[model samples]
Target chain A: MTEAAGTAGPAGSAGAAGVDGPGRPGPRRGRVLEGLRAYGLIAAMWIRSTMAYRTSFVLMTVANFAMTVLDFVAILLMFSQVDALGGWSLAEVAFLYGVSGVSFGLADLAVGSMERLGRRVRDGTLDTLLVRPVPVLAQMAADRFALRRLGRVTQGVLVLVYALVLLDVDWTVAKVLLMPVMLLSGAGIFCAVFVAAAAFQFVAQDASEVANAFTYGGTTMLQYPPTVFAQDLVRGATFVVPLAFVNWLPAGYVLDRPFPLALPEWVAFTPPLVAVACCALAGLAWRAGLRSYRSTGS
Target chain B: MTDGDGAAAGGAAFIELDGVEKVFDVRRKTGFLKRERREVRAVDGLSFTVARGEMVGYIGPNGAGKSTTIKMLTGILTPSGGRLRVAGIDPSRERTRLAHRIGVVFGQRTTLWWDLPLIDSYRLMHRMYRIPDARYRENLDRCVELLQLAELLEVPVRQLSLGQRMRGDIAAALLHDPDVLYLDEPTIGLDVVSKAKVRGFLRDVNAERGTTVLLTTHDLQDIEQLCSRVMVIDHGRLMYDGPLAGLHEVGESERTLVVDLERELPPVEAPAPARVVRVEGPRQWLAFPASASAAGLVAAIAARYPLVDLSVREPDIEAVIAKMYAERASA
Candidate 1:
């Protein structure tokens, strides 16, 4: 049988004409575009799947929207008792809250499902993703994407609009351009944190709570003025986790407020740089985690 | 042998492993703050070469490294030492590239989306693999026709029976016309009819497309019907590699002969090397080497006893493998 198979190799090769050999690495831009296309395809399928249950989808979206609204209502009640919080007025605090909310919301919508990496690894689903032709990161990030996450983004935009109508600050061309930059860089930083924290699941399969402390906890802490926290906590947020880059420093410049810790004005322009560095570090962590992966027994 | 010799021999060796090894570190908590770390050699110094267009059966007992070998071939788990290659590409280094040329199906799990219809997963794969629209449609139509998936195409994967889901998974793996297919327990937990259908479809696929298949199965019938060459592994090492007929000779296996007499009588007086191993009332069973002819033994028993009915049973592959393992251990 082995001899017959060896003799039929040429005929087999002819039948497999449609199959390609090991593919050469394509150009960087082409690969990036291909990854994006694949991500879009997978995410669209998830959205359609979620939309299949109309009442459930609508109820979940409304519930999510209502829950986030009450979070802001707590701040309203706080202002009824006091004039300002940590030397920032109601509108300034609202601005901070809005920026952090929108940034975290966008990040969650994109890669929040990554928190289930521990479960995937334990259940052997990661092996399925590794065999696909697409990038594993893209496949994981787009898995089970829920469109209801847009609820939080809509609420954040509303609050930001209300704050813009109330606060009176001298707006400039740079500030106008900086608004979109801050939101995008903020989202980038949050996405990096989500991926980096999830990467630790490869080593400790049940350590999802440690990731939640950094992601959801960090967003909640960022909603208030940085001055309200301790000096050491603020320093750690600034240097170690870089959560301050999400909105605090950039919003300070936009609001023309004094820097917390007496920092220079140039610090506000560094959010983009900080976001890039954080994402690079997170990419490294993800790669290392993939290398160390010990798949479950079959 | 060196890779130079392998490559110089021919390109027929599509999948080659030269002393491939995979060792896992397992840490167990023995006491309070005292742990013991140990190395588990799941696949130790395994080597084999599978030629293209060969449908080979890889069978072994549990924890014998069958799944581990398939995982290494697909690049899901990298080997710790030695060399491995498929289509002249290192699986670990160029997994994504190699993925385009190989297809895999795990019967224990489904790659299809749980909430989506069967066709939806195939459509997602169409775009994910960037397969040409014409080729994708052709392959999907062929698989659906052969596997009888037309009635189940619109049903959500979660609602399908185990048999239906297995067929769905097999179709998903082949939509891209991959050069090689790795199936780990494809017909496990399946009914008799489902197993036959799957086997028939696989035979058609191999004969028509000439797709190379490496199957890991606990079901010996899956081997007898599909594969011509079989490799037996035990304790992370290859113990036997030859034709299925040769495995019986190596294990010194035996076939059973049952003889039913006219009435309750003593054990049948069988010939030498074919003694009655068991007797109940008028029925007696004689054991002989599987390689020997059962016709002469039947004649001898008929000549001595008043036989009413008689039958012969072939040796099962599991018993052959067990005997092989026991012989190695005792030696």
Candidate 2:
């Protein structure tokens, strides 16, 4: 494609301007379009390949749909064990679970490729992507989307909406907008964990499943008020590791409850900020892993 | 003019490699936790060139830097020290750009999408090279027809037999219609019929499209059938780089003669005109010196004993190459 651009220019003024002649105004635009070509290619392959196993695809989707109902089962089982162990009401805990369900499911749907990244690297499959003109991250991003994750996302949104109704707070446009931001923030946190796990695979050859502590454990921590957990361990994970951004701080902002850790209402924005930082770090770390792979030929 | 000026005098060579070397430090295992490190030179001080449309057969024993050199040429591995160019394009600096201009086929690897049908991979490659849609269709049709892959277009890659898979792979490489095609053992593991088909297709791709092809195959027939020039590498060094014909005529020990005799040889041997290679039932293998005539050897054998049949055979590539390597080693 770059070569074609070289030819696209005329002999008369070829060296003067790096432009592909005036007749074709889209030459520069074409270069940008080419990078996206690999993404489209992988997505199309993923769709066709996944659809081939029809029964398994449907079963997985159904299992995920059923998986959401387990949240209600947990709450009901817990309520029977005790009226309320923590000071918070059951409805507030349900609200936290709902927001987490929405964000985590969306993260799985959008960035699931990071989970299989170790296997791709081991098999030399990613080598093909490297040889192509596009950046490797873009190609990885384009591969595999789990539409079935809609079950969890939907369940989470429903519980969040119910919690909002029960609380009966005077909601404004800004407050309503904060919900989506937190949801996206939750996604960023999970994706960062995946990226970090994938990056570690370069050194270990196997993905660091410990990263799941931040993702799955982070989700669990989000389902309850942060005050219930001891300040040393859970508090440290929330403050230092920032799982609180996913639910605790954001929940405090939304529920109008006093947060165990002192912070401003601006804490609702923690999810997006931390998520972005994690993503950028993950991207840089992924690139560092790629360089290591090339040097080592592993 | 000096060598540099001389090259400039004749218009720069299509491809050039100057003293390329690659040394890798590998961790060698010692007892248990005590592992020693060693630096293994994969390629060293190698240099060669290919003019436009030249099909050079690169051959070497296993682990003798053949792969390392090819990787350097293809821009996969950066040579520790060298100046290299392919069609005036620096492969390493412009690796991604070079991808569009060249096609690569590793017999052990497949570039096609694993799960997608053959056509889908081709379509994806079409977008990759940005071959205009009409040109993509034209090239796709030509490659498909040439490779006899029209019937197999919808078939997934995993289902194709080794022969069929190789053919599909070659077609995939050409789908982008690259200027240079790097074929690393393109016909390995193929049956006689499939091997012939692959060789025929490659010859045509070179001749018809004027596409420069660099093929590395263990099958010497691949060389004799396709390449005009052969480059032999041994121990990370260029042993020989010239016409295939020149290799056979090394050092005047040329030609072999066979005499079929009806009667057995006498217990006491007579002075022979040529050295005998072997003597089997009704067959006498004789090596004729380049200085001597085959008829002289045959007539002398006939005078000494009754001969049923007589014929002369040009030394095969195996004998020539083996002899070449052996002689180069001792030298």
How far does residue A295 in candidate 2 sit from its true spot (Å)? 2.5
- fnat, candidate 1? 0.35
lDDT of 2 by residue, B210-265 (tens): 78888887888899899999988888899888887777666344677877778767
Q: Runs in model 2 with CA error above 4 Å?
A: A1-37, A64-79, A82-94, A143-170, A208-243, B1-11, B28-35, B248-274, B277-280, B283-331
Which pairs clash inside model 1? none
lDDT of each: 0.84, 0.71
Report the Cα lDDT for residue A27, model 2: 39
Q: Compare the candidates by lDDT and give the number of the best one.
A: 1
TM-score of 1: 0.92
Candidate 2 total steric clashes: 0
Q: Could you give candidate 1's per-residue lDDT for residues A1-298 as a string of tens digits? A: 0110001111122223223233322333444565678789999999888876889999999999999999999999999999999999999999999999999999999999998998998998888988887667778889888889999998888888888988997899888888999998999999999899878898887989999999999999998999899998989999999999888898999999888778898899999999999998987788777777833332
Candidate 2 chain B lowest-lDDT run of ten: B1-10
